[model samples]
Target: HTPGYGSAAKYIGSITKEVIRDGLVYDQQNVTLLEIMGRNAGWLTGAAALAKCEDCEGPDMIFLPEIPFDVENFMKKVEELHKRKKSVVVAISEGVKMADGRYVCELTGTIDYVDAFGHRQLTGTARYLAEKISREVGCKTRAIEFNSLQRCASHIVSRVDITEAFQVGGAAVKAAFEGETGKMIILKRVSDDPYICVTDIYDVHKVANVEKKVPREWINEAGDYVTEEFVSYIKPLIQAELTPIMVDGLPRHLYYTDVEQKQSR
Candidate 1:
């Protein structure tokens, strides 16, 4: 996992719990769709399960990019849940695909825009599904996309992730000073009980361009949600929170302009 993943997971988990609470405000039946970012991995989407606790029942279903999505099955599940509950929350990855290997968002229309890496600008997955559920199930539906907020939400950053990020950078510098080349620093989990992580250097060539996906065993047999083991693995990463420095009423952040002005002074 990457340094920023832990912070993003924390934000997702916290927001999912809040959304679940908001969904139950009314007596009417409603389906809330949370669209999480995951091009090929489901780590962020799975984090929604972290919201599950004694007080809060997490999302009713979680769809990941690793699994081939079935629209019929999804609709059936939603209908069943709607019949029993007043509110149904679902967490879905933007990159989730049909068995035919086409993105769920592409079903609405063609995505003309593509990034430099040839990846489509994946969006509207939640909106399309929400509309479909409303029309088919005849109930209220809402689509919530976290978008860039998932990655840039510095206000709720994890202390563990922040500290490890610094450690990784320092380790890289140390390795370079020791005449090491073509090396990348990686976090090695030495202990799970204490959640101790240590930095180790690996060949950059071997690490580059390799996508580490969530293991198949981590997902449930139904492929609709993650397992308890998955939650246990991520729980440590988001254990501690880093409080932001507030100025007046907002969190204070350093900008490049401020640095330039200080240098001039």
Candidate 2:
């Protein structure tokens, strides 16, 4: 797993719990669609399952890009859930594709901008799906996109992730100082019980542009949720929180200002 993934997963998991609670406040039938960031991998979307616990049932369903999405089946599931309960929460990766290999969001015809890397700027996925559910399932719907918040939620960052990030950076610098080239620093998990990890340098050629997807067994047989093993693997990463130093009701940050630079000069 990448350094930032742990932090992102932490945020995603916490938010999922909060959303699940909020969804239950109303007595009417409602469906909430949470669109998480993931282009080809569903690691972040899978994190939503971490919200499951005794108090909360978590998301009723989770869809990942690793599996082809069936819109009809998804609708049927939501309708069935509505019959049993008032609120239905579903987490879906923004990159979920149909059997025809087209992104589910593409069906909305709202994606026109493409990045330089030939990747479509994926957004409005939750909105599109929420609208569909509201229309077809006839339930009140909400579309929530975690968006850039997932990446910049430093206030809720995991302490382990931050420490590992610094360690990985230091490892890279140490490697460069030792005349190493064309290599990348990667974290190797030494153990899971105590959650120990160490940084090691690997050939960049072999590591770069490689996508490590969530294992098939990590997902349930129905492909609507993640398994216990997946939860166990991620729980350790999001264990400890690094509370930000707050000043005047806001988190204080360290930075070099122009005045400081001029004074030094």
Candidate 3:
């Protein structure tokens, strides 16, 4: 996971809890599909599991891009969950694709172009799944994408994430100044209990152009949800919240635009 990912994941967990609270307002059964953005790793979407603390049920199912999307099985899974709970929340990574390598959104004829890196720009995975499930299961379905909100929601930022992010940037700059030209800065776990971590420098040649998929063992056999092992792994990163300063009735943000405009004059 990248430096900003922990904060984004923390944002996702907070929002998922809010969505679940909103969805269960009425006595009627409902399905809320949250489309989380993560290029390939389900690390961001996996934050849904973090919401399953003592008071929250969290997402009933989490679909990661690591596993191939199966339509029929997904429909069945939603149906079963709907029968048991009035509110069934599903978290899906936008990059989730079918076994045949076609994105789930592609089935609906939504065309997306590839980037210079040949990565498909994906969106609308939740909407596609919502429409499909609403037709088959005949349930009240709502779909929402976190989009840019996940990255910019500074109000609910994780303190752990922000600290690590700051350290990584400084460490990278130091490494460069010391003539570590081909090195990339990465966090290596120092301790899990006290949750200590240290930044390590790695060869950019070995780390660049490589994508790490969530380990197959991290996902359960059903392929619908992540194992507790995965839950334990991500929970610590989202441990503490960093509350943003309040201005008037809303949270204040530090934006570069205003500063840039002032400097230009």
Candidate 4:
């Protein structure tokens, strides 16, 4: 889990192209963006960079917590990009720390610890950055936190991701029935769109908090975004695939299983 913003900026650049083609590029080269996610691990943020890399007018400068933040250095980088492109997008992780070893997000709220995984709960880091940039850079800035929406967002689950999640759960059940205890099934995506996945068994303890991070090789350093290699790697996960079911403008939840045992009265 090497820390850096290069990966995130690249992924976000990829997905942004779709929106740009749809006329979502209001700022294009002028708009600046801040992405908030990842304090210890930037997996999600890396994915965003990959998304941005796919866009024609992707982000210009990205900031991640991996590198201890220096306000002067950041301002200098942003100013450089702005001068080069007129409009710029800067992605910053909410957990970015300062020279004094404090997170910029602290101004919004007190950093609280949640015992769930020793990860600091966060808020308003993007807004804080946006305000600072607006005042200093004198450019309109937008801050977007992917939020829980990106997780339960069944819509965005790469066809690959959803299928793999399902297969892993199903495999875990099957393995349990086979007396394979203390193990979990995992889905490994081999490709995108058409959707190819490989399911394997892994020890639950072996994967807990063993974060897989974005590879720097997938980032285009010169372009300040991700490359097609990363896009191809993740494209399958976001396939528009869904489970077949009847819809009535509401949830189609069913309460019972198809098979049942006979009643013994």
Clashing pairs in 1: none
lDDT of 3: 0.86
State each candidate's clash count: 0, 0, 0, 36
lDDT of each: 0.94, 0.90, 0.86, 0.58
Per-residue lDDT of 181-235 in model 4, one digit per residue for the tens?
Answer: 7776766555555556677788989987876645666656642445667656654
Tens-digit lDDT string for candidate 2 (97-165): 989999998988989998876789888878988898888878799999999999999999998899999
Ranking by TM-score: 2, 1, 3, 4
Candidate 3: TM-score? 0.92
Index of the highest-lDDT prediction: 1
**Residue 29 displacement in candidate 1 (angstroms):** 0.8
Quote the positional error of residue 152 for candidate 2 in Å: 0.5
Clashes of 4: 36
Show where candidate 1 strays beyond 4 Å. 256-265
Give the alpha carbon lDDT tens digit for every residue of 34-64 in model 1.
Answer: 9999887899999999999998999999999
